[model samples]
Target: MKRRAQGALEYLFMIAAALIIIFLAVRYLTRTSSTATDLGNSTLENITQELENAGF
Candidate 1:
């Protein structure tokens, strides 16, 4: 029936939207994690340089 077809279409749309959201979330998380890692590495390097300069 036409109603059944409409119901199927709605379900497909919802699934597609959900997938897009999930993809965006994963991308955001990856970006944030990389940024955090870069910051940590920079901090470590600075500390190491400071320690060496102090004659450690």
Candidate 2:
């Protein structure tokens, strides 16, 4: 019974660690995507301003 309990505890710890890693990965991806979106938006705005200046 003691051995079984130990094994269960080990599995629980492993699962917790995996969840933390997955969460971090997802957070990083989300931040990167947001940054890319912001950069694209800024670029578009710059282009529009330039076009207006050229009377387009």
Candidate 3:
């Protein structure tokens, strides 16, 4: 009976660890994507302005 309880606890711990990892990964990805989007927008704006200045 104690062995069964130990096994269950181990499985629960692993599940909790996996969930934490997944949540952190998702959070990191979202932040990175948002930052990348902002960077892309600024780069596009800069290029547009430069092109206009060049009379293109």
Candidate 4:
């Protein structure tokens, strides 16, 4: 009975650890993607402004 309880507890801990890792990874990816998007938008706006100034 004690062994069974130990096994269950270990499984729970493993699952919790996996979930934490997954959450962290997703958070990191979202932040990275948002930063990239902002960078791209700013670059595009700069290009458009430059083109308009050049009489495009």
Give the whole-model CA lDDT for all candidates, comma-separated. 1.00, 1.00, 1.00, 1.00
Off by over 4 Å in 1: none
Per-residue lDDT for 1-56 in model 1, tens only? 99999999999999999999999999999999999999999999999999999999
Cα lDDT for residue 29, candidate 4: 100
Q: Please, what are the lDDT tens digits per residue for candidate 4 over residues 1-56?
A: 99999999999999999999999999999999999999999999999999999999
Could you tally the backbone clashes for each prediction? 0, 0, 0, 0
The Cα error of candidate 4 at residue 27, in Å, is 0.4
Report the C-alpha lDDT of model 3 over 1-56, residue by residue, as the tens digit: 99999999999999999999999999999999999999999999999999999999
Off by more than 4 A, model 4: none
Sort by TM-score, top down from the best: 4, 1, 2, 3
Per-residue alpha-carbon lDDT of model 2 for 1-56, expressed as tens digits? 99999999999999999999999999999999999999999999999999999999
Best by TM-score: 4
- Deviation of model 2 at 37, angstroms: 0.5
User: Which ten-residue region of model 1 has the weakest summed lDDT?
Assistant: 1-10
lDDT of 4 at 23: 100
List residue ranges in candidate 2 displaced over 4 A.
Answer: none
